[model samples]
Target: MMITFTRILICFLLMVMFSNLQAQQLFQLSDDYIVKTYSERWELDSVYQQGTFRLMSYKPIYLAPVRWSSKPNDKPTSDNPDFSSTTSFPYNNIEAKFQVSFKTKLVQGIFWGKGDIWLGYTQKAHWQVFNTGLSRVFRELNYEPEIVFKYPVRWKFFGGQFRSVGLSFNHQSNGRDLPNSRSWNRIIFHMGYQNDDWIITLNPWIRLEDEEDENPNIGKYIGNAEINVAYNYHRHQFYSIITHPFNQIKGGSIQLNYVFPLKGHLRGHVQLFEGYGETLIDYNFRQTTLGFGISFADW
Candidate 1:
């Protein structure tokens, strides 16, 4: 099954690359890409704007009413003996999942007007709304807050434009106590590139050790590096994220998202995920999930 999935993924990526060639010749960034994913995302075109309270979308915001998991981590455990859980919860395989993320500029034109700093926050939750037997409890929730410093770049790499580079201090946690608790801190470096309808981002992070660590083996499961690739074809969008791509032996995950135009700015979204770290509570658990929903914002 893994081999079959890997083959399909390779074929899908090849098709995207072929389509990208045609897209580059026919479409230009000046023609106004729908989302303007990279430029507007990083504020690459503009330096500083005068605003007291302006928040921007930092990641995709969507709610999936129907998300099915191949395996539910009813009894979550950790490599750290002290963090392992002995309790078991009645978690349903089907649930509702949603994510909300946003960012705001904190300091404009820092470091002699070469970079800007932003504060960002993201929250994700899994709710077993259909599992009324368990009183419709929330299965898991993860909170992430970060501070990033971004610098605009104009370098060219293999026919693509290197748009921006950034560094961020990120903190992610489930905000729970004891055996169910999960948290981590990282110093992440970011690099973004754009070529016509495609946008690529590379993130390599360093884990900051805690004296009272909750999940010391998190780096092995959650990974040290990740890559995001996005392609836009008219009103349709395709996105893929691969973590620990270079070192799959340590465990990795692949997430694919397809967004199609529905009505106006609303979009129909379909997501497929496999491998580990679907949620903080299930960080070391391996699973495959499929979700169908609507998307309000793009990453």
Candidate 2:
């Protein structure tokens, strides 16, 4: 137990060590090669809040109970008649509820002409942390590492600033093997626009075909693209993620988020999720869940 805790501590330290380096170079002026200061941007209630991922809809650290609306139909790999998928999972899922999530950009620099590169990582874990009756196991952990190339653009539509355009390659997986493993790679195009307190980004992505199909039917439930819209007012941040299923049969997921300052460097976070894609294991299972936790940064 002590060894496990030590490892987790080490990981957190490494994440912070790398993220701090990028935070120093975040959102800098491209032409002048000078760093962008917080005073140049809009004033915030807290200086600690001035960081990256301001317009991105996804945040970290959400812990709450989840109820499955439609449980997935089990698939059997072995052809035994009595074979059941639930044999590996006999515990009551209704009692499992906990989460630890975070994202950080490790490094960023000017890459080429008028463009920059950033390396970032985000992880989401569903923990039965408090469910001691179930041996307090971690249910699932999904790690995503992405490298993005961002280029500033001078364009406007709907009277807003067309801030930047980004292209990236992202890979997401649970790092598990065999029956429970899930992984995918995608190419994303990001177009960002901001008007006053409102920020919107359209992320159109295409999944790269793979030789070994882990979750073959994932596209039907998670869809081909995502849209993020966020509005900032005073010290509050509101955001949402929308996805429409490719087919009418399997539904998509919609997540709503609200974050406000609770104390110094600490903010109260509320997450409302409906439909699918709540977790990798529940990618095809429809569910509704609400999580309440604290976040250090929305970026």
Candidate 3:
């Protein structure tokens, strides 16, 4: 069964990539200042004794205007940068991401019925093109592979209520072809309380061995904490997340996500994230980033 599932996933990924390739060419040729992005994510969880399994997959496409405004003194603006006064075309940024994850578990309960534990793995790939509409076009790719293990905690708080704890390991690095790669290893501890209508998760994480271009000392050890709140009303779901990063870099980020059903089996997601961070892949120092995305969702 695992083999069959893997085959199906591979086929789906190939089709998605092929479609992106076809669309990319057309987007590149278009005269209008436009940027396009795509993303895909998949997740699976199962329990053998409980005979329960869960699967989720999502794909989203985004299109945005490509224009940045700059001052006459040569200062660049943000995503929608202002180039109204000057003849120089503003730099355009384009990016895309793809992610997949799967998990399985088996459990047996003592007092009531049974409980289960699960393990999952996730892979994410991201591509970015900087200055798409300008003279210099720089492209970069990032890949992350992660693993998660989850187990249930019997009622310690209230009756008919349950808690879950999970441990996750993640490795992030640049694609092999990229000249400069930033890599990090992180270990995360997550605790969650779940009921029918609401779920709240707290994640605390630490990082070890941070490097840029494989340099050992260039990176700093950091700690991060995150809180996620999710509420479901029928088929619609709402979620918000707040993250705090500490150590050499100090800042926080907040994001809100909404999922709504669309036609057929398709669903849509509207998400926004705003925050300031010390370092982004290429930028030497800290910077602030504000962005929003619309995509397909399976929640």
Candidate 4:
């Protein structure tokens, strides 16, 4: 699996590097989170217009939906019933079929010229909201926070315009301790470019070793880089995120997202994902899933 995924990634990189490109264009920054995502091609938007951050558009508004994972994973603490109900709560959860998911950034802004910083957080939880037999227990919740700095760039590469570059510090965990604890941190470098109607972002990161090493070797499974490519056509958007390890390829993840304007302000979204790392708890697990929902932005 890893080998196959790596090959795919290599081909993807080659194609993007050599692809003919013309110009760099992104939506101008505004007071809407959804608009912010599609307006600017990169997190560091000052490259387009260096100015103050506005209200309401501080970060992403909210992206909420339900997802179904074909493959389920057990918690390090649960999936085994010996402990049954611990002092924390009720019985251990058996992976639920459905989940309530959403991720939103807290705040982001540019404090000075050419340099901007951002603070963001996201959460995803497994919920048996419909199953009455199991009393509708919550399965797992993964929390993530990240701070980033983006610098506007003006350069030509691959016959395309380089738009932005920056660095970020990211942390993800379940917020549990001991047997249930799982967390990791990363220092990531990102660069952005645009070609015709396409926006491209490349990110390669290094995992900061944890003293506790919970969910060790996550990088081996999730890879060291994440690439996002988006294409725009009228009122439709098509995007995909891919990650892979070059040395070994057994584990990796690919996600494709489609957004089409359904009406005024609301857009229909469809997501198809295969492989691993959809959530923190499922960081080392593998699965293929299809999720549908309404998105506030193109993603």
TM-score of each: 0.86, 0.71, 0.55, 0.71
RMSD of each predicted structure: 11.7, 8.0, 11.5, 11.9
- For candidate 1, the per-residue lDDT at 244 reads 74
Query: Model 2, range 70-128, lDDT digits (tens) per residue?
Result: 33323422122222243454333443344433334323234443454555556676665
- Residues 1-299 of candidate 3: C-alpha lDDT, one tens digit per residue: 32344345445545544644464442232211111111001111223232323322221233212211121112222221221123333433333333444333323242234333333434443333344454443333344444555555645454324466667775655433222434556788867665556666788887665323342322231227778777767656677776665564545666566765555434456555555321223222223333333333322
Error of 2 at 67 (Å): 9.5
lDDT of 4 by residue, 71-129 (tens): 55543333223312344433222333322222222244544545666544445566655
Maximum-TM-score candidate: 1
Give me the candidate number with maximum lDDT: 1
Worst 10 residues of 2 by lDDT: 31-40
Query: In terms of TM-score, how similar is model 1 to the real structure?
Result: 0.86
> Clash pairs of candidate 1?
none
lDDT of each: 0.79, 0.58, 0.42, 0.59
Ordering by lDDT = 1, 4, 2, 3
Model 3: per-residue Cα lDDT at residue 291: 34
In candidate 4, stretches whose alpha carbon ends up further than 4 angstroms from where it belongs are 1-66, 75-112
C-alpha positional error of residue 81 in candidate 1 after TM-score superposition, expressed in Å: 2.1
